[model samples]
Target: MAVMTMEQSTSRSILPAAFRTAGVDALAMIVAMVLAALAIYLFGNAAMQRVVTYAAIMLTAVLGLQIFSGNTGIVSFGHAAFVGLGAYATGILTMPAALQRTALRDLPQFLAGHEMSFFTALVVVLVLAMLVGLVTGIPLFRLSGSSASIATLALLIIVYTLLVAGREITRGSQPFYGVPREIGLWTAVGVAAMAIILARLFRETSFGLATRAAADDERGAAAVGVDHRVARLAAWVLGAVAAAAAGAMMAQFLGAFSPKDFYFDFGFTMLAMLIVGGMTSSLGAFAGVVVTVLVVEVVRRFEGGGVIFGLQMPVLFGLTQGVLAVAMILVIWRRPAGLFGDRELNLLRRPNAKMDPVKPATDVAPTRAAAGPISVDHLSRRYAGVVAVDDVTLSFEPDSITGIIGPNGAGKTTLLNMIAGDVMPSSGIVRIGAPVRQASAFRFARAGIARTFQNIRVFPRMTVLENVVVAARVVEPGLAAAEAAARRELARMGLERFADRPAASLAYGQRRRLEVARALALKPRFLLLDEPAAGMNAVETAELVSILAAVRSERRIGVILIEHDMRLVMNLCERIVVVDRGRVIADGAPAEVQNNPAVVAAYLGSRTARARQGNDVQ
Candidate 1:
């Protein structure tokens, strides 16, 4: 027995770090829930046991929502539709043939004649829910923000309407009876436990991490090669499966339910539980369900006119909903992120050891073996008739460091943006290995181009290591390899010490370096940096120059920089392109550009003139 235990421990230690953490979190949650259920079963009456079962079913449903909405930061008001579908499907499939003939007389012959066991019926319901989610999500995921949320609300209304009108299938707003009450307290708890585990595991996967990165900052995620819509769609399908499972369990628990059971009121209650507890973690889903269930039980005792403090009270029709609404408002007001705010219950786990910084591989190669020079031909961009990049032509080789020095509004960043596929050119061609048309930033990133924004854009809520891991996972095959690559980049940028900390906690200079590290993880053929040194002190700027020079030499990849600091530009760049008023004024070696009359007039100005006069005086 000891030998078997040792083998199991050794095997578990080799799993990816993220999965291991998630496993521990899931175990902790399951233990807590089992203990609570045990107490209820041992001491509580039958009524309390039924309430616990109901709460367990609700927990499963809410966790399903967290899998999609929490990771993608998209509020979904339509998930309850899947829950309703699950109930109807389960009732139709599992009801006794005699009962089905009487209750759903017009149901399809195939469905009316079936009497499936609980587990078999659940499988069929889940598949139906997944198909439905896939069809609806194709178009809905295309829209984002408030628009996507409102679209979900519309979906709920549509599903509700269908259920009410489809008398043959759903009994038309009447109770769907005859589903066997096979799900007792233990069965419901078992399903909820599975949901909690699945939710935690999914959050540690590449899809969940990428979706979360997009939620933090879409532009940043794009630079790391994440397609937000695709990621969200995957989450939506899985969430639908979970909701359907919960709905099946609920149907058995009730033995009868109607479309109204899963409509507006139920939807609001599920969302309130999520919002009030926290939406970002599985622990929050658990906490929210527990709190909401307790509130409902207490409020129900007095809602129908009960003696309180030895006095008679009047009946209150909507007291439960009104109180829940106020509770949600108070929680949102006091803690906008909810009670636990992305934190998990990890009391049962041991503290993790500090990760040792790994040296970057010496033979790291660019993403493409023969990625040619990036060329821009007669590119121009206009904003309301005002030219931002005017008829610019430039070529950047894959084995050189070039600096683009220009005054503010001189269009250096605009040209960079066009090359990186963040902005469209008014009329021109951009060839990164080949001429491209209408490419998005993520596509450009996947095609051997990576860039840093003019304004620093890091995933603030993600760990410093996770920000790099998000980029690494784009190219690496698995989470373990991604984490290894991320550690290498963090070590290269001297950010390994802070790897476990949230990116938002980093200093301005550190965040700037963090962005560069994230870009490097993509292994791009061309690195475009915009104002990387803007907020850095002299020491940090000098360090950045050293790092950039080393990276360009070691990787043999093209580096195009836009900077206002003349000293750093002159020292680090092998070639300089000087621009003034959206036009290239001079393009040559640093010494030649420094002496050019046009360049001096446009940029160097009084500072260069004064320094020269002092040199002559000395």
Candidate 2:
């Protein structure tokens, strides 16, 4: 009976327990899918079978979209492009050879000669979709939020235009026909079930969780060594493949469809399903499909002027579309997260989570004590007329703590960002061992440099242990190994007791330590801490100083510490680098810098220094 603490329970009252358990959530999906199969088998006529089969097809496509859109928190409207490609691929291949000779005379030689089974066509569709995903993901992933969404919409338009203009192969917008209809109710049900299972499994994998962490906070994920580009691209390709499969299945099910079938109308409907159900989980996808299908069916009956039992109904034009629009709007207004809202129904017993007291590793590998010193050679960063870091030169040695202290806007953080590869330098180079060329944040992170932000940026949705495990995965390949390492780090930070608690439930000081713990999980050679002691009380600050001492003394890890606390910096650092107005003002030992006249004037002001010394005490 493992349960969250009082603090943890209080923070996520709206979240469901089942949503967090993969086994339970997956079982719920299996049950719903089985019930759908049972219903179709027991009482389905030709028309009823068509309705259920169409719903299953929609579910498959929606689940595919959920893999990327739900997990990455990026809304995409371009999945239909892949669907359209799949439809064309299947249509061209599965169409009769005689029809291909007569109608698709303008198609490529290879395509016109090939007419394959559904499985073979599906494989080809998947490969083509993956190729498109790889090409498009490179640039699209560089942008975020609304910009990324708009770019995907642009992709839809581009693909649609290409399909329309490519008249030779596709017969333009005139609708190419004569395809064999091989997809049946059982086939759709089986594929839909597979899609649901795949989506759920992917969402629970280490790679999937890593993408979600990035979606929550990109900078936080980067600082912890998550490769943002790679994770997003993997998801994009996977989603594209799934979408392609659904498209092939739909083409075979519908018997014939035009380019318009997979364009805006289909794309918007699929996206709306994901949004109205809850884009974060597969259960939401399933729930949305069921609700939309039911609503559409009822509205269609009214629009057709049908008789319900005995009485004849009045005809209602566009009623089906109007109802769907209103339902989507109402869902958005009332429950913006959708009806299920990332929750899944659970109906199974599960094993309890093991909370074994983790023993310290007997043979813990030591951090690189003699990793070559990080050298900053006249590094500069300028935006328009403003210079954030102006030709600052410094070198940090291995196995020592170097303190960077200065007033606000003195470029201390800017220097760290350049070294860590967050900001590209306008001029000069940052060499970290062997003169490495072209440094980026991911490159520096992989090269044994880890940093923490001034404002704490822990992934709020992840547990205390998960936050550390995500970073640990960079160095450790196995999930078991990573979780074990994360536990050790948490124990070292005295956070073992709160391992299962969400990061947001921790106190301010605990959150700060968690950030440090996450950084340590990277096995960094040089740690860059930006104002780590910012929001700490006296006791907490002293604890942080002690923890830093242990990190240097025990692990032999070098630290570049930035702090406004003069006492802590002066006492802890062996060498101090002081900067003022984007340039180094003084660089020396604590004793020398404390007494230097320029240092005193820049930090304390001449009058304030004199007043403190009783020389200007009116």
Candidate 3:
């Protein structure tokens, strides 16, 4: 037997082997689902079992939707098309050749003559659905917000039309029967369990984290080097695969169906489940499915009422739908974040109040020699006819603290935006090492540039540690390495204790510090800060000054700050650039810029103008 070294033994015993591979939340969810399935299997009648089985299938589909819509905050109305495709593909492949010869005679010769097992048909359908998702996502992911949602709705319409119009392949909205009814309650329960695990695991991956970050704050995520389009596309493809699986099961369960079965009504029902339960987590998806299915079943039984309390009851048409709609509205009004609110159901105790401190990995540190001064030449930005930044040529050294300050509307923020690649220059060049020809924030971030917004843009839905991890992942190779880097930054910024707390729950001063920590986690060669101390109190401002001083001393990275806090500017910045009315008026050491005649005249004139305007006000 070989003896283990102390270091090896310590590492091995640090965390449970199972938790290293999976999260507590995922395991808890799986257990809950299994128990629920067992309850139905043991006690329910055949009819109740059937309803639960159908609910399991719906859960799979809803989980798929949650994977995309929940993470990207982009509601998709077209995912049902993938479900429909899966059902039709499975049916066509698994149906007997004899039946295909009669019912689907117009199917292609290959499809008409062949039949496959349920598992094989499902595999084929999943692959086909992924292909469709990729092709559609290329165009659809290019859009965001309401435009993207509308595009998805259009996708559903197009797919529905194709299913109805392709008379030879689909029989043109007619029922295509003879599908093998091989799927039972156990099969659906197994698939749903798998989907739940897959979704939960994906949510913990780097791609999923990036997608959720982008959903929370697009510009902020971009500033941390997240590729929003790529993240969204990955979620889109995965969600389609899940939806396809659900469709395969549904086809075998029902044995026969028409295009209309997966049309508007079907899509709306799936959407309702996601909305009512919560659109942000796998747990919410599960809860929503159970609640919706139970409500629907109960209401359905009373639709053709016989009697209640010895009184005759009239039949109520569409009562289930009406009640569902009202329930969704209530959930939206009372709990807009959904029932779970982006949280997982974890019954296990939190492993530890604080994460084990990990030393900073040397390989992930910033290479000082690789950084060069950022040069901006004749940079100008215009909006319509008004110039936001006009011919403001400047250079920022790689190891200096520079401040750009003036009265309100002095274009300080605009100038910083141009340099950080958040805004396009109308007619000028910004060079990190070479001229950057495009305005892309994520590209700049990946090239050793990181920034914080004037308004705090932390991903509010993410934990404090996760906010920094998002940026750290840009430079680190894997999630573990990224987390180590993040924790190091959090400790340095005095946020280690609040690592598990939501970013939105932090105090204003703490949020400001958190933003700085997030920016620092990128190991950027240049860091741009806009009004970092805007809402901070005097004590917080003093702490910020010390933190910035230490950062400059330790990292030797260039810092460009835009603020109206004169005391902070005078104390923290070695060099100052004064801008007024979109033009640079003075630049030198802080003392020199402070006393420059042009700087004094610009401030005095602006104050006078403001006073005159106030006097003229009604």
lDDT of 2: 0.82
TM-score of each: 0.94, 0.87, 0.94
- What digit string (tens of lDDT, one per residue) describes model 2 on residues 1-618? 123234224433532232346566666776777787678779778888888888888888999899999888899999998888888888898888887888887888877867788888888888888899999999998988889899999999998888889888888898868777998888888878888877887775667767888988888888777887788788888888888889989889877778898898889889888888988888999999999998889878678787877988878787776787888899999999898885544343122344567654424544465678999898888989989888888999878999998878888888888888888899988998866556577778877898998889898866787798888878864555677678888877778888876688899989999999899888888999998888889988998898888777777778999998989998799999998878998999999988888888887773465567796555
Assess the local accuracy of residue 141 in candidate 1 as a C-alpha lDDT between 0 and 100. 87
Give lDDT per model, in order. Answer: 0.88, 0.82, 0.86
Q: Which runs in model 2 stand beyond 4 Å of their true positions? A: 1-24, 102-108, 204-206, 305-314, 342-354, 360-363, 436-439, 497-501, 606-618
lDDT of 3 at 500: 76
Mark the 10 consecutive residues where model 2 has the least summed lDDT.
Answer: 1-10
Q: Considering only N, C-alpha and C atoms within 3 Å, which residue pairs clash in candidate 3?
A: none
Q: By descending TM-score, how would the candidates be arranged?
A: 3, 1, 2
Total clashing pairs in model 3: 0
User: Which digits, one per residue and each the tens of the lDDT, describe model 1 over residues 1-618?
Assistant: 576456335534466677878899899888988999999999999999999999999999999999998898999999898898898888888899888888887987766777999899998998898899899999998899889999999999999999999999888988888889999999899999999999999987888998899999998898889988999999999888898899999899889888899999988998999999998888888899999999999999999997898999999998999999999999999999899988776443333446675766656666573578999999988999788888999999987889999777788988999999988888899998788878589899888888999999999988888899999888876787778778888988999888877899999999999999999999889999998999999999999999988888888889999998989999999999988778898999999999999987876674676789999999
Clashing pairs in 1: none
Estimate, for each residue in 1-618, the C-alpha lDDT of model 3 and write its tens digit. Answer: 123244334543464322344476776766777787789889988887889889989999999999999899999998898889999999989988898888877888776766999998888998999999999999998899899999989999999899999888888888878999999888998898889888887886778889999999999999999999999999999999999999999999999898998888888889899998899988889889989998999889788878977888899998887888988899999999777767766444352377566543333347642578999999999999999889988999988999999989989999998888888899899999999979999999998888999999999988887799889888876666676678889987888888877899999889999999999998999989999999999998998899888877777889999988999999999999999989999999998997899999999999999999999994
